[model samples]
Target chain A: MSEAKTSANPLFLREEELRQGIELLFFAYRDFTSEADAMLAKHKFGRAHHRVIYFVGRHPRISVSDLLDILAITKQSLSRVLSQLVTDGFIIQHRGPRDGRQRLLELTEKGVEMERQLTEAQRRRFARAYREAGAEAVEGFRKVMLGIVDDPARERFAQSRRDGGRDGGRERDQ
Target chain B: MSEAKTSANPLFLREEELRQGIELLFFAYRDFTSEADAMLAKHKFGRAHHRVIYFVGRHPRISVSDLLDILAITKQSLSRVLSQLVTDGFIIQHRGPRDGRQRLLELTEKGVEMERQLTEAQRRRFARAYREAGAEAVEGFRKVMLGIVDDPARERFAQSRRDGGRDGGRERDQ
Candidate 1:
């Protein structure tokens, strides 16, 4: 069956292979988030809180609009999570230097600590997978992951990587 | 900075790269699920419903206990989604032939069509990524994704792939 499907498509868009890919993404993601979800539960937080602190830590001084863009959540939805994080002392909001009207988000020391604990669990899992998959596989993994992003967001994703590689000192938390 | 980090570790377990991987997974999974979420929303269904239909579609006649293990959701949580799907004529539950106490789950015609629509959207994304990344990258993508699964689940994941490859006649939903 796999052979027939492969033979039907020179590009190797076999349904069987594609289905496996779909299931792989589903199962792998389920497990990947479980660890961080467990950690967040201990802090009386949820995945939404983890996402807010994570992005803030990664992109220090990120504006609220930019965060909303990244999260693709409604302002009202974000407001609730942002409020919880701020009230819990995990995040700080500041006025943008260039545009005072824009609110910039950042992680406080406590927020940074929470981000570390959450990401540490995920990092260990990723590091192990990277090691097992090797350098070439890692490149392939990156290519596929990048390809999965929507067109407009793909540019932002690439820019973030470049920023992380070059300006490691800009953000002390991440 | 990347060079220094790489040079510092022979295993290539640099924190920077690992963090990038975490973000990649986050961004990719977010985008991937967003497409399906939109489709499910049109049917007045949520992600939980989509997940139940997906796994049941993949593994026909899958036992309730087995599905609970795969989803890792509370019995109450599963009960809610399962009851909804069954009531909506999207799923059919039957007693096990050997053990009458065991409830086996399968997608009805309506359920199968729903699964196909949802999975077809996801498959297009995966196919585009696989084609652009090429076979080697796809191999890497699969390897890394597989490695990320928990130890016990990894075995089930591989078995599912094998099942899909050989027994394509089952359900014909996925």
Candidate 2:
């Protein structure tokens, strides 16, 4: 039996092994979302609402137009979630200083707290994963995730990094 | 500047680092779903339908209750997707020999083809990521993902593994 296994090309990627990787992605993604979904449910919010809060929290002065680009969702679809968030006092929207038609969004104190709570749960999971996986694996995971982004979105993502906000950390000497 | 940075323990986990990981998960999950969503959109099917088809395809003789358990969705919600898949001839249901009330599901030829197409996109993504990361990171990714699953679902996951479905790659004696 050992010889039979050894006879196969151990280095080669098999179709079956590729299929297992696909199933792992499916199952792993589901597990990742389940925790966040439960937390959102308790707040009478959905995943759409969580996405808005998350991005707004990430970029304090992000405009709705920019948010639409980030989310890749229709304005009409985002409108419902955004309006609720603003109405609920979780997000405060102000007219853009230069672009009157654009609405700038920021989280309120309440919003920040909620965002922190929501993210804390996720962060704990990720931190544990990172610690267990170690630094190299975390780096690899980040690269893999970055590679998965679509070409156009990749450009936007890079631009987001370049246009540093208050939240952006100071440059670390490499 | 260095003194200020050194005031805090650099080796310890920080709020900023934790938040960065949170953002990465949000963005990564979004990118992961986008490929599958585009394909499902072409069929006028949503993620819900895709989930049903995927789990059934992965476990050919999966029961309705078992699927609901795996999906962690309400039966009513799953019924809508399952009914559609069945009506469209993408899935076929059979009565369990041991239990008449239990309905076991399997993909039709059409369903199998559709599942293959949907999963291929994801598989290609994982394949590239795995190869880039190498074996250790892939193993770490799997372990971390399994750890993230909540207690109850973790038990279901373990049971599913024992059942030796496609999700569970048979152990090869090496």
Candidate 3:
């Protein structure tokens, strides 16, 4: 990690800088989710539940397999929280129109409301960050974060960005 | 949210861009932690355990209260993970030299080894992100992330940044 410590050009990729990057990520993520976490706790749900809600809201009719892939969680693990959400009227899963065996997930109106509240809280924080940093800094932030994102997910996300925020149901991988 | 959707400067500060930023954070953090998560899971441990080990490794002789503050979790919640780590020989507790009543914590050699492995994985990703984005973009990433970080933590983190990653015990807030 210290391999490049002595290099000029003021490059900040040394071990020290790298560790700072890691710590910043930890602190930033904690603050970003802290609010929504408290909100989820009020519903007796956890971060896993929040992930399901946010994704279902973002990609209406996203299939169970697709969601599992996106969340990278096992079926059994996803099932417990998912079943609770459905039972609580937060999400509804329907049989795929084209395939009876396929389960397509969507947020209930109640779920959408919850999603909005959660996402709005997050977006407010992100917007303030962007506003404070200006347009150029925002791009740098995205570039670095996108680099942190693994491929395929990165590509899909970029596509969503290019799509101009037309979220959900539009690209349900039918 | 859509208030600035039609601005002429391509400001990317509208609801669309804001939502995209939110999604980027999700994807980036998931990818960042996924590897370490898998590693921790192999030991039947969870993210909570990882956080305890990482902080203990970083801050030798840190008291229980300071950890609770950094984690922003309940004493009961942290106690479960902390005790588990201690029982598992990953952490050790001692009476603070200056304050016998203060229970100071440090990582065992085994724990330090684990911390190095876990942190090395994360640092590699962050280094690649920094390398890919270059130094100019690195500042942008830090600026945006610092904005996401809430008060006091942000200031504390900046101080650490200025401290050049000496880490832990030096700033134990004794």
By lDDT, who's the top model here? 3
Instruction: Give all candidates' CA lDDT scores.
Output: 0.81, 0.70, 0.83
Q: Note the residue pairs that clash in candidate 1.
A: none
How would you encode candidate 2's per-residue C-alpha lDDT over A24-130 as one tens digit per residue? 55565666667778999998999889889988997787888778877888999999999999999999998877767767899999999988887777777777777
Off-target runs (Cα >4 Å) in candidate 2 are: A1-20, A155-174, B5-13, B152-174
Superposed on all Cα atoms, the candidates' RMSDs to the truth, in angstroms, are 4.9, 5.8, 4.1
Scoring each candidate complex against the real one, what DockQ results? 0.53, 0.35, 0.58
Residue A125 of model 1: what lDDT? 93
Q: Which stretches of candidate 3 lie over 4 Å from their true place?
A: A1-13, A165-174, B1-13, B165-174
> Candidate 3 residues A1-174, lDDT tens each?
446444432344276688778878888888889899999899899989999998888777888888888888899999999999999999998998898888889999999999998788899999899999998998899889989999956876565554455452235465
Per-residue lDDT of candidate 1, residues B21-47 (tens digit): 887787788888888999999988999
What does candidate 3's lDDT look like per residue over B1-174, in tens digits?
A: 455444443655377688777777888888889899999999999989999998877678888988888888899999999999999999999988887889899999999998998888899999898889988899999899999999957865665554454552335555
Which whole-number lDDT from 0 to 100 does residue A123 have in model 1? 90
Cα TM-score per model:
0.85, 0.79, 0.84
Least accurate stretch of 10 residues (summed lDDT) in model 2 chain B?
A: B165-174
